[model samples]
Target: MADRLDYGEGTDAQQFVFLLPEYLKDTSKKMKTGLMFVKLVNPCSGEGALYLFSMCLQQLFEIKLFKEKHHSWFINQSVQSGGLLYFATPIDPLFLLLHYLIKADKEGKFQPLDQVVVDDMFPNCILLLKLPELEKLLQHVTEEKEIDKKKYYKYSREKTLKWLGKKVNQTMAALKTSNINVGARVQSNAFFSSHQISSDKEEDYICYAHGLISDYIPKELNDDLSKYLKLPEPSASLPKPPSKVAAQRQKRNK
Candidate 1:
């Protein structure tokens, strides 16, 4: 398997070899001009959805998140590649959406933002000590002597990934309700299918400064991007079941 390029956190702007900054600049201009590049199916209608999306992006930059290389890479790749690399923005969109909710709460929208929403919005910001609050459970396991630590880690990781996937789908649905669509499904599937982390994972995870490399990325770096963020690969489609009548006919012929 060929290695894929991973721009880990992309902190420096000087390393992008094949990236076209002019395209990013043009996109920002278009986004500001209220032009609809992608079809949106929002209830807000007109330019309200675009305005809100722009506002979110603006607020994101105001908070200094725009300096984050992941975001820069996301914005550039998304536009330069024409949405082929939409997932390059590994940060959850909800994190950005939280700013809007916070503003709405300040204005007495929806009876103030809930504490749960605050934590959801700022998971990395909150600090807690010790076990904090605990909830008791009625059911008890009789024998819990031996669980394989590796297996437990794998199981927990799988469960967490599953939960995150559902949340992502729900967020996408919510964004769509607001008439915002991010990427084409076909392109997304192709991205996932082409990038898989396996035995050569160590070499595959090498972090490269985008601007420091040559004008073009190494061939290995073009095949995978697991170092930037870990995501579940899209599953290969299952084969369709054979038709029963056809199977019986074939058996009779045999």
Candidate 2:
């Protein structure tokens, strides 16, 4: 058989398993950023990609913020479907990941899974959002009491573009940095073992919540995923991902 990828929930849903470190195995102690597993019920299509990509960004935000001292903002569109907007800081991802991870862990979602596969699934898409545009959305959403769905989508699209443009500019600047100092130095090590080191050579920039970089995944992996995903074509507006060296540098910096 196909190894029955279904995790009791359904076949369409993808379940990711994360082994908790020995320190996190204790239920009595609380973890600030420990995730056991994650389940994506969305279909593996464009729509599903959007939500999954958003989740990856959230995780990256949390990882890069505490470890790298970078910060950004995000609002869960799924939560805001009821017309109430809740802006979250990058730190919020710690809690968000915990919530989903706990649920999946309890149900043994996709138990006995390969950790490598799960790790590879992350950074599937890099979104370059402008900090100022995020600020604008935060201001607008907080001040406004009632927002229709139509207006929300329209506003999100507009602001997202502005954010992406600014993000591109920032990445370009980082690449041009003669000293090669991407941002503030990170004293502490990353919590996740898969964290990448930044490369010396500049490539495409993935404007994540905490900071920006490129080559989140291996070239072969990206090429494979490209077969299924209709990712945005490389354009002046959208920068390409960095080379393998840049990815290594990202890991080292992390």
Candidate 3:
């Protein structure tokens, strides 16, 4: 959920509060010039999304801002209105690579990873090719060939489905272990002093994990994953969601 901010019409100066991983501060000592913000394709939306790239660490981070109407923050010496809290989370580079591979798949040709990743609109996509062990990561979702000692890859639907299944399983296990309340039966008893929420139904875990995982892939692949997992059809009455500011798909006029 990376965001690209814009100064809205007639907007006032605002303050930002961020919660970041400690590792970033540690990594900063190695190099200063390699840190930057770049726009690249969002694996889930196939749209421009902002990301923070560290060429030194070869790491990519997803920035997510949490905003609420009429919120304000009081710093040590001043009060700032429209204050928002942001988080920096590590993103799986493979997901981003898969986005390009799926698009390249339409060409019906095995192409070198570098050739396949070129983006005219978001040229910084080349930085992704610099990530370490990229060949090993691509093995999860691609079929490749070696030509003249160079490797070429094409998206492998079979392999990708298997990989996504594993992702769902991993997310589901975390949900269960964290004692998340995902079922209506659990939430309905929220006010009861004697209630326990960890006993949610098995389907609850699957649905919750699917919702979270869907944010990282395109709608078509999401639908395919749903079917592959045999998830029950979602009800049409519920509207989709994500409230954030961005020039990306996640953005809306604030």
TM-score of 3: 0.73
- The candidate that wins on lDDT is 3
Give each prediction's root-mean-square deviation over alpha carbons.
21.8, 18.9, 9.5
Write one digit per residue (lDDT tens) for candidate 3, span 1-254. Answer: 11222233476322223423332454453254455667899898789987777675678877676666686654445555664656445688888998899999999999998889999999999989888898999999999999999999999998998999999899879656645555654332122111353466777678767777889999999999999999888844322222223222122221
The TM-scores, one per candidate, come to 0.20, 0.28, 0.73
Worst 10 residues of 2 by lDDT: 80-89
Backbone Cα, N, C clashes tallied per candidate = 12, 16, 0
lDDT (10s digit) by residue, model 1, range 1-254: 01112343655211112233242336555555432122211111111111112221221111001111442222333432221211111222332322333234344322212332234423422221111220111001011122443111011223322333444355444433433212222221121221232221221212111111211222232222222234334333311222222222233244
lDDT rank, highest first? Answer: 3, 2, 1
Candidate 3 lDDT score at position 114 = 85
- Which structure is stronger by lDDT: 2 or 3? 3
List candidate 2 stretches off by more than 4 Å: 1-24, 29-154, 178-240, 243-254
Q: lDDT scores for all predictions?
A: 0.25, 0.28, 0.69
Off by over 4 Å in 1: 1-63, 66-126, 129-155, 184-254
